[model samples]
Target: MTTEQLKLRSMIVTALFAAIICVLAQLIIPLPLVPITGQTLAIGLAATILGARYGTISVLLYLVIGASGVPVFAEFSGGISKLIGPTGGFLVGFIPGTFIMGYYMEKTSFTFKNAMIANTIGMFIILAFGTTWLKISADLSWTAAFAGGFTPFIIVGLIKAALASWIGVLVRSRLVTAKLLLPIKPIVKEESI
Candidate 1:
């Protein structure tokens, strides 16, 4: 296939995964000024399957949709108001998480240990941005913000990271073995005289 075709296919997958994540967000568990949802699992899956840049764009697209009154976020809220809400920091965090996971996955072996490390680091990046934004938006001190934004999800994030790593390793191995996913570079033809 042509490079353009490959790129288009990747984009389509990215969007599909993002939309799926949005749908998962609707299954919410309300907490104190926050909510728990399965969206991170989708984020993990997307980054694992799609790679970094495309994965990030996918999550950004999901954010845009949720921010536009799409009824796709956790707790069935939408529009820019959701973006500025208390949990907005976590919503915003999805972007970098997807990117970091996707990017690192591409360059590394899909071993369980390495993949888990990469996924964990990716989650940390997300939490860092999320907690920082939460502090600012909520007018809380750093410790308070971190407590509010990061504590509830710490265990869950670790769980999701391990799950994502497993999925990544399995999916990538199968795809490679089956020759299902196209390589990044086009094949070069040799001229034989």
Candidate 2:
């Protein structure tokens, strides 16, 4: 494909992933503090499939749309309030989490093992940001924040990570085969002739 074609394709795919995040965010199991949502799973899938740059772009787009009162967040809630709300840290954390996850896959390989490691690390990053923000925003003790935001999600988060890894690897392979997504090329240093 030409450079323009590639850029166009990337833009389309990035926007599509942002929509996917919005749709998945609505799938929530409400909790007292922070609800369990499919947002992280979508983030993992975006990173595994789109790599670092496009994946992060998709996440940023999602945030922007939600913050603009698009009702794309969990429980169909949105706006700046949602972004600064108690769970907002988790929302904001998606940016770095997606970037790091995709970056790891780009640096190593897009295999299931790598995706698992990346997703697991990404999960912790979100939880850490969310827990800290929860403590501060809610004016709760660290122990309370841990109980509500951190501990409750560990097992479920691992399950979602594994799911994202397995599914992401499969889907990424198919997209590459179909040419919907291009495989990442490794960088090589040029030697003087």
Candidate 3:
């Protein structure tokens, strides 16, 4: 494909992933502080499939939609307040977490083992930012924040991360085989005569 065609394709793919993230956000199981949501799962998948820069852009787009007062967050919640609320950090954390995750997936061949490790680390990054934000925003102690933000969802997070990694890589492989998605090309240095 030409440069313009590639750019357009990237845009469309990123938008699709952003929409998926929005839909996944609705799959929430309400908790006291941070509700369980499939948002992370979608984030992981986008990262694996889209690579670091594009994955981060997809997440940013999702945030933009939510901040525009769209009901794209958990329990059909949205607006700027949600971005500043106790769970906001987790939402914000998705950017860096996904970047890191995508970096791993992009740098290495997409394998189930690699995906699992990348997603697991990404989960930790999100939890760190999220737990701290929950503590500060909710005025809770560290232990309370851990209980509310981290403890209640550990097992679920692990399962979701693993599944997102495993399934995302498989989907990406299929897309590659079908020539629907292009592999990331490393920049080549030109020699000056």
Candidate 4:
């Protein structure tokens, strides 16, 4: 493909992943504040497949859409309030988490082990930001925030992370083989004395 074609393809894929995250966000189990949803899995999938730059773009697109008063968030919630609301931290965290996951996936050989580690780390980033935001937004203590935002979601988060790692990596491999997605170039880092 020509450079322009490649860029177009990348843009299309990034937009598609953003739409996927929006659709998946609707699958919500409503809770007091932070709800359980398929968004994390979708986010992970996008990051793993699209790599850091494109993956982060996809997530940013989703956030922009939601912030623009589109009802693309959990339970069809949107607007600025949703962002400043109790669970908004999780939404903000998505950017960093996606970038981290995608960056790691690209830097490594895209192995399952690496995916798992990256996804786990990304999950924790979400939790950290989400829980902190929950505490402040909800005016809860740290322990209460952990209980409400972090603790309740731990098991489900792990499951989503695992699924995202394995399935996203598998799908990426297939797409690369089919010449549909660009292959990630492994990044080499040199340690300085």
Candidate 5:
């Protein structure tokens, strides 16, 4: 494909992933503090498939759209309030989390193992940001924040991490093979002759 074609394709894919994040964000299991949504899963999938640059772009697009009053957040909620709300930290965290997840895979290998590790790290990043923000935003103690924001999501987060890893690797491989996404280039070590 020409450079223009590649750029166009990348843009389209990025927008598609943003939409995917929006759709997945609506899948919610409500809780007292924050709802368990599929946003993380979608973020993981975006990183695994789109790599660092495009994946981060997709996440940013999603955030901008939601922040602009589009009802793309959890439970069809949106607007800047959703971002500045107690749970906003998690949404904001998605940017760096997605970037790091994709960067890890790009640096290592786009395999299931790497995806698991990257996604796991990404999950913690989100939780850490969210918990800290939750504590401040809600004027709650750290312990209370941990209990509501961090503790409750551990097991569920792990499950989503595993699912994202398994499904992501599979889908990424297929996309690469089909030319929908570029294949990961293996790192070659150079030795002094």
Candidate 6:
């Protein structure tokens, strides 16, 4: 395939991953008032698979799609209103989170240990951005913002990060192996009768 075709294919893959993450974000874990979603898992996975640049682009596309009233955000909501809401910070944070994950994935990372380290960094970045933004946008104190935005999701985030890293590396390794094993076409020659 040509370079352009390869790039197109890469974008498509990134979009698909972002769409998957949006859908996954709607899967709410029941709680009293606030609920949790598996959104981070999708972000990390996309970044790990797509690498840094494509992963960031995929997340940006996801935000655009969600902001365009597509009902793809959590609870089937979308638009600018949601973009500026309390959860918006976390939503925005996903871009950097994905970037972090993809950055690590591109380096010397195949083992679960490396994945763990990479995902941890990604998760922390997401939390930092989300918490800080939450404080500024919502006009809440740092402690309160973290209490609302970060505390509830700690365990789940860790789990998601581990899962994304492990699964991503495993799949990437297999893909590499498959490509290495693919047979090359042999040229055929006809002899004169």
Top candidate on TM-score is 5
lDDT (CA) for every model shown?
0.77, 0.91, 0.88, 0.90, 0.92, 0.75
* lDDT by residue (tens digit), candidate 4, 24-53: 998988777678999999998998888899
Taking the tens digit of each residue's C-alpha lDDT, what string does model 2 give over 13-113? 88999999999998999899999999999999999889999999999999999999999999998899987889998998899999999999998888999
Residue 73 shift from truth in candidate 2, angstroms: 0.1
lDDT of 3 by residue, 37-149 (tens): 99999999998888898889999999999999999988888999998999999998998999999998777768888889899999999999999999999999999999999
Q: Using lDDT, rank the candidates from best to worst.
A: 5, 2, 4, 3, 1, 6
Q: State the TM-score for model 6.
A: 0.83
Instruction: Summarize candidate 5's per-residue lDDT along 13-92 as a digit string, tens digits.
Output: 89999999999998999999988999999999999888889999999999999999999999998899988899999999
CA RMSD (A), model 3: 3.1
Candidate 4 residue-wise lDDT at 70: 96
Residues 81-156 of candidate 1: C-alpha lDDT, one tens digit per residue: 8778777877888887788777677776457776787788878877787788788888989779877788887898
Which regions in candidate 4 have their CA more than 4 angstroms from the true location?
189-193
Instruction: Give the TM-score of each candidate.
Output: 0.84, 0.94, 0.92, 0.94, 0.96, 0.83
Count clashing residue pairs per candidate: 1, 0, 0, 0, 0, 0
* C-alpha-based local distance difference test score of model 1: 0.77
Model 6 misplaced regions, further than 4 Å: 1-4, 30-34, 175-193
Top lDDT model: 5
lDDT of 2 at 44: 90
Alpha-carbon runs more than 4 Å astray in model 2: 186-193
Give stretches of model 3 more than 4 Å off: 185-193
TM-score of decoy 4: 0.94
Clash pairs, model 1 backbone: 69-79
